[model samples]
Target: MASTEETKTAQVRIQLTTRYPDIELPDDPGPLLVSTGFRRYALSTLVNNLLQTERPVPFEFLINGQFLRTSIDEFLTANGISAETTLTVEYVRALIPPLHVSSYEHDDWISSVDVLSGSSPAVREAEEVSSGQERILSGGYDGLFRMWNMSNEVIATSNAPDEGGHTLAIKSVKFISPQKIASSSMDRTIRVWDYSEESATLTPTLELYGHKSSVDSIAVHSQSSRILSSSSDRSVGLWTTKKSEAPSAPENLIPKARNKRRKLSHPTPSKTGTQRGPLSLLTGHTDVVSSAIFSPTDHTVGYSASWDHTIRTWDLTTSACVDTRTTAHPLLSLAAMNGANLLAAGTSARHITMIDPRASATTIAAMTLRGHTNGVVSLAADPDSPYGLVSGSHDGTCRVWDIRSVRPGVGEVGGGQVGESVYVIPREILKEKGKSKAPVGGEGLKVFGVCWDKHVGIVSVGEDKRVQVNKAGDIIRT
Candidate 1:
């Protein structure tokens, strides 16, 4: 018998095309080229070898005087010949040419989430220090302003006499120093407390009573000792502490109820009386001033949001109104981000608007966020990450948003135009689903305030009358 290699003789064929008019080729080439009684064997031997080696096969094949480089896979797929089809080497080469092949895979998603504590507090506000530590200060119908340690434990609590019982309750609290805390109450006074000793003692440091109505909010300048307070009287007052020889008296600057309930007619100058008053009254809002805050980067610049349906920026140095933008709805909360150049304002309309103070104070609706179902009452910015912001709403939840993702470029989107929302953290909804059925403590949990701690992530307080600490991916129990 003949040797196996010699017995398995492979067929080889070739064909040339030069504009042939009358030629009938095989209906199914099957890796073979046949035309006008001419049979061309396929080139399967070289193709099989190249495919097995996982390499490209570059071979020149002639067809009608034109040369081309094609791959065996492409030639087979194009000719309706599948893997099961077997053809000789010459027939494959005559029917198709060898070529190079490239393949690619699809892109995948790489994003994740982190849930934190929730709140349903009547009022809440937080302040971060030059140090990385954060101070969460909040109050509600409970009539007490509680300060929590970074661990979410109540480090100190400031409460007035039960007789006083915080008549209107503590609306807001701020930290002027690590040992000093300032708060405004519905009782129409601003009290400063000192934590110098082991125990936290409440001292009536300053009685800012120019406003005839309840004091709504207060903000301390990062650089100066000046304090800015807004009130239901629709006025902003700037206060400065001074040392006096005689003992100071705590007095209600407002007149008795018999007198007209109008705002204080005469301005109260600083103690020297020679210099203008430390409390500069800004009078432009038609309605109550909902919130006021100093610029994080520039002490001379301040911002205020009001129920008057407008947001105003102030040049504190000149004590003049810098610019104002009227909104269709009342602004309930305001926060500054991106080194104080970006201002985020949440409205009663359940929409958040971001404004570039560096710009012409134009409203950038594109960057607006609309996730809260109810009115937003509180707004806080992440001190460590200016692009990160947390907002608390009467809707009983706090939303965390990443400002950077809202737009493509940095300066301003579409020349002061707003970009769409990027990310939102529905903290309240998450907490409700995670709560235990049986109450372990005296009262159930509810979130009142939401704040970002540089080291601890987000800290919050609620009607549950407890402070809860939350990191991005996990919730830290105090």
Candidate 2:
């Protein structure tokens, strides 16, 4: 009689197809005889070896859309799979959850386009034009704002008239409509330009000048023509777009497009200014307010991050500050996540503090994320991507953090007392192309703005004067 192991083994015919396109493998290779063994690892190895051509590649197996992870015999037995059953399995590279980044998978990411450099230093911010994905707007420290086509080339070249653009370093840029854009600058003024509609050279239809200091950031309400702008003046101002007389500064607003100059007709003013002064100035933070955003869930409710080491939520209906709480570190940036019901705030300590706004009014972070070696100054929450949040730090790296993997545990570091009750989540790092990933670090070009979309991947700009767009994700092996 055969030994117990041999007696229990099943003779299964295994048909294989690689799910990873980047890690090349054979196409339609003949089936192999796989004996379902007591050891799951051995069966996994047999399939992996046959799927790989040059070297064995790591993979996860699924049979008939059902995932399999343990010993083959046990799994089959548990699933009521018979000994004579033929197993058709699909082999795929190991995967990190969508929107999440892993240290193990930078090789799969490719810089789809060569770095698109700007005319200035430190590309401060970037946003995809929602009306048309073909156009992307990039703001810079060189006091220039340029629009690029889908190909990453500057728009309005050789053919169409360019819009009225900023003259000073643009601190914030937001698209109000496909043809309309609002940009705030260090020049202490905001311009609302008719960016795409008219045929003639584009110029500001309205210029907003109310904030006493350079505006650091701006957010537009999803439901109305309202805007919230945070300034170095240590206050957040709320403004609305009211019908005004013709613009008095139309001539001053229009700048000669790069390499192409077109004179614009002085726009006859129906309004004297681009916008009326603040509907209400949210004043409380003792230091510069770095970022303010309308809550994605409720437009009337919004949050602001300040250098005062505090985050404040205000009621826009009354202009009243409703909640205030101090954080663990000086706040530099903020990204409000609706899906997770969490406020992701970047801090001076090279860490990210996620707060449950639904929690009591106390200003405590529910959990903290650490990896960067310098202050984290920018954060972008991928609404479509539930697995992660992207951060840009002073260390010149844009890191994607997988929040889905964080769990509560007990541990102590940095002089903070840890009790058995405290929950601790371990650390993860962002992987970079060409460079080996640091055990714990971010990846970027001395970033100022970081944004990611399912289709666009991660787009970052910084002191390097170049816009970097990385198509990050794993490819299937053929």
Candidate 3:
């Protein structure tokens, strides 16, 4: 019976393909047959042998839009697929798990994070070569934003409220250029700053006054000089980085919500820079707008995720809400998958929904990614690949996901696929390192923001008031 069963063991046929231009096989190599026991390693070795490369490169394989994590026989059995069918396997460079490198402590809860890589567009345009150094910018609940160097040194700090900085906690921040920074705050204003690295000075350049409620987040298009901000007032503000291009605030402008005045660190006359107004105010969301971002390909189009349980598409050229897609839960964060034509929205329901915002698309959601134990608060698109995405959550972890590895919803009511994360990065506890740093917030370690940089693998900030760096690639040295 054992020998009879062995005789019945099937051989599967596969055809390999890749998007990588340099790494490829013959156009009509024909289908190759292999034993069902082969896994990723065995298949990878086979490809390298065919390429005849001096060095072997690790490869990941995908079949029918999902990664093949199991042996060929096991995968076929689990999916009820037949061994007689020829599989088209797409191979790509395997991504290594990110390693935790360094952490910088802050005074209060860190709300947002961004990175300016050595090879960023702003740096490249200046023709300045960075000696493998990247700058990190962090916004805090302490009503301040700070710039840090690779050595964990504080390079520059924003002024206090009395000295023209935000009077309330900053909610979002971004590096507009090497010399410019932008931040939105609970004070209901967006401030642009002139950063002088040589002098370690951060001076206020412009104060944008338009939103009637606290500004929740801000997105910048440096090349176009445009800024998009989300607010609790249920509107998105569209503004410019240049003051000369902005019009004066309407004289009839009124506050939407009443706020209390708090005692400042120093009571003095306000020095809050030059004031300006938004180019247009986008209103459509019925609930608090948590995030707003420009389209990955088209700057004239924008998307916003809100507590109203809807994701809206806006025509920036006409200041009109063009389309909206409703979801089951409130959305808290959003990011764009460049070249993939998809938007990822982190939801209060503890999962990220992959949305196809195209008008001609029939489905509301293309897929759903799950694994987080708490609300996913923030998301960052991978700079390395269009199919990759990273999310930070209140569950005290950041999850790395590959959109390509998805399957049809097993029990999901929605007519879409579902994906699981490739990796989960947990909050690093200082106590584990023999250091005594107590975490803040009721949950103690919820990640509030996350960003992926070309040079900086992944940067995450949380209720622990720490900016943690996770480095990937063989070239990164801690």
What does each candidate score in C-alpha RMSD? 21.0, 12.1, 4.6
Kindly report which residue stretches of model 3 are placed more than 4 angstroms away from their true locations once superposed: 1-8, 25-29, 52-56, 77-81, 119-129, 250-272, 430-442, 475-478
Q: Stretches of candidate 2 above 4 Å error?
A: 1-133, 156-167, 197-201, 244-275, 359-363, 407-444, 473-478
Write one digit per residue (lDDT tens) for candidate 2, span 353-444: 87777646343666677667778777877635443577776676666664543433246222221111111111222232444442333333
Clash count, one per candidate? 31, 21, 0
Report the C-alpha lDDT of model 1 over 284-373, residue by residue, as the tens digit: 989989888887777778889899988788888677887887767888778778554777888887778776766564444436666676
Candidate number achieving the greatest TM-score relative to the actual structure = 3
> TM-scores across all candidates?
0.58, 0.62, 0.90
Model 2 scores a C-alpha lDDT of 0.60
Sorted on TM-score, highest at the top, how do the candidates line up?
3, 2, 1
TM-score of 3: 0.90
Q: Per-residue lDDT for 403 in model 3?
A: 89
lDDT of 3 by residue, 1-478 (tens): 1133452466799998987777777554778998777889999998888888798888889888778887888788778888889999988878888889899999999999999887554453754537656789999999999999989988899999878899899999998888899999998989999988779899998888899899999999888889999999999999998888998755334223323475323322226546789999999999999999999788999999999999999999999999999998999999999878999999998999999999998888889999888889999988877888999998888999998888669777477989999888877775476744333322788999999987877999989899999977684121
lDDT of each: 0.52, 0.60, 0.86
